[model samples]
Target: MLINDLIILQRGADLTKIAEFKLNSFNSFFINFIALLIFSLGFALILSITGIEPWLAYIETTIYNGQILGLFATLLGVVILHELLHGLAYIIFGAKLKFGIKYLNIYTMDISGTFYTTFEMVVILLFPIFVLTGLLLISGILFPGLIYWMIIAILYNISGSFGDIFMLIIILFMGKNCKIKDEEYGFSIYT
Candidate 1:
């Protein structure tokens, strides 16, 4: 059994198991769905309240003209970009990076035993959301033709990020100076 480096700690090691970030598939799905709903409602409200006619027109045109294939492609690209940002952050923080996909989940991780500081892990978690949102916004402005794709990417990116946001909340409560290892299921925090 080749467990990643952090797995060794759980298998039996010197470090105390401070916390286990157990993943719940149903919870993740539920939260992501709820987030999407809330965001959509809020965005609609803002557009209506603020009288953002341009945005309204763009969205109307997009909904009417967009194809299923384009939507899927844009969303898939956002997911790929999201994982790449995690990989980039991992490398920037001195971890050996590896990428993998299983079923619908695409991921980038440090395969070796190298664990990261809480701050480093936070950056790894959030880098994608911030960077991608910024890029999508800039692209939407610079190339109006991409507005349809950008809107889809933005919606997906924000909704997809709730998992990372949940982990961020967890990391905030973790013990100070703790080491974090990305695990298959979630995270293993060692103090």
Candidate 2:
């Protein structure tokens, strides 16, 4: 659906383009941060509850032992590069430029103004995976110790890529006429 359509949504359009973009940015960042925290906390809780052997779970244990400064730097680097890929993909497809954000939920290109076919959509969706994978593989092979950072980068990209993955699936199966409508987290794809 288009941005104007979104304004006519059932609850009534409550946001201007700038407001919506700002809200989206805040939501994206907050959600990703909360998800990561919850994921880590739940994993830790499970391990503690199960009485896992600490030394045997050395990888898990060591992750938490990582240097805070290094972690933040790695995360910031991954996020910036990831968004840059998105922006570049938009340009390659000739889509109008839109805002980019560091946080997961808030980041989006406001290219509803332009139309793209399924193939172009696929290109946009898959660009980051292709770019980041090349970067990850090269870095991991050259400096094996950087595997952790690679993992962080890949997962970070994938977290946001879920929407693209869904888009690709629908466009492939349902054709260009397919539209994804929300019903909570999972979407309903129909003509």
Candidate 3:
């Protein structure tokens, strides 16, 4: 396995470009930060309405030891697994992928730039949030001892997905005629 301090997934545009959104841009970064808080609030509402796990359970966990350390470890694992899930969805959609750490986290790129249709790209973006949240919920329910940590991991993973969520929002209006290429910083939409 190879790791780098930074991974450059950016490539020169080889197709007609409509718009390019960048993660490092001021507007996008502001939106991403706000999106994190929005996701947290939204998911919190979902959990409360569903009552899948009592809010108290997430708070008072005397059942587990070393939760502080364990939670950090779990979050890190979830982040990597989150990226892998994105890659998995891309592969399923017949896209060639490359993995990279734009700053300090994993993001997947379609190596060929124009491999994914709008719908497929949406699936790739949303896949991890749904799958990981479901898995975490199930594990939390089954292993009551882990509910506290599992819930935190779920929230972190979801909120951490601000970039994907933002891209998905933009892509929804882009229609199915466009192709998307993932970039180290953000994404490119091609007509």
Candidate 4:
């Protein structure tokens, strides 16, 4: 209903629907699994190149007790932070923002009345991944004691970004001045 309302309100004489996709459970799982595998391999390659063993980091962290709860809390915080980063990017680019959660999935959106260039939209979509990954890498390097947790957070965040990356790839191939209407489950693009 909300998506239909948005479609009615945003439709213009020249605007044409270029593409649409819904992120159902099956695709979401598949995409995220692939992304996680890629990110893990990449992270492992980085560690190997630097001669830094994650097992060493893990073993050291395991010596400290009660980190399970701390890790859980950190992951929860990271999910919230990831959505907030998306909202922030949308706002910075002058788009109206809305955020919501359904079941276990959390989403942040640019509601309406805003159009973005391909570059701007790509930045908005990928901003969280870039920021989180950079922070985690820097923190892990600076504070070796935190590397294990940081690595976990980085992988989790990357996996969570599957939907955004999917949308980004779609938007990249669309017209330069495409507009996006974000829904809780998916997005519709118009050009």
lDDT of 3 by residue, 1-191 (tens): 12221222232344577877775657555766776787679777867786866655654453354356666789899988898999899889766778876444467777644446788887999999999999999999999988767877888877877778777888777767887777657787876
Question: Could you tell me the lDDT of residue 46 within candidate 3?
Answer: 68
Clashing pairs in 4: none
lDDT of 1 by residue, 58-160 (tens): 6677678866567788888998999898888888977777777643356676766667788888899999999999999999999998875786688778877
By TM-score, the best candidate is 1
Candidate 2 lDDT by residue in tens digits, 95-172: 555554343443446343444455666777689878886887788789876665565566566555555564576557
Candidate 1 stretches with Cα past 4 Å from truth are 1-14, 49-68, 101-104
RMSD list, candidates in order: 4.1, 9.2, 6.5, 4.3
Instruction: State the TM-score for model 2.
Output: 0.56
How does model 3 score by TM-score? 0.74
Candidate 3 clashing pairs?
none
What is the alpha-carbon lDDT for the whole of candidate 2? 0.56
Alpha carbon deviation, residue 75, candidate 4 (Å): 2.0
lDDT of 1 at 12: 43
Query: CA lDDT of 187 in candidate 3?
Result: 80
For candidate 1, give the lDDT of residue 191. 78
Order of models, best TM-score first: 1, 4, 3, 2
* Shift in Å, residue 2, candidate 3: 27
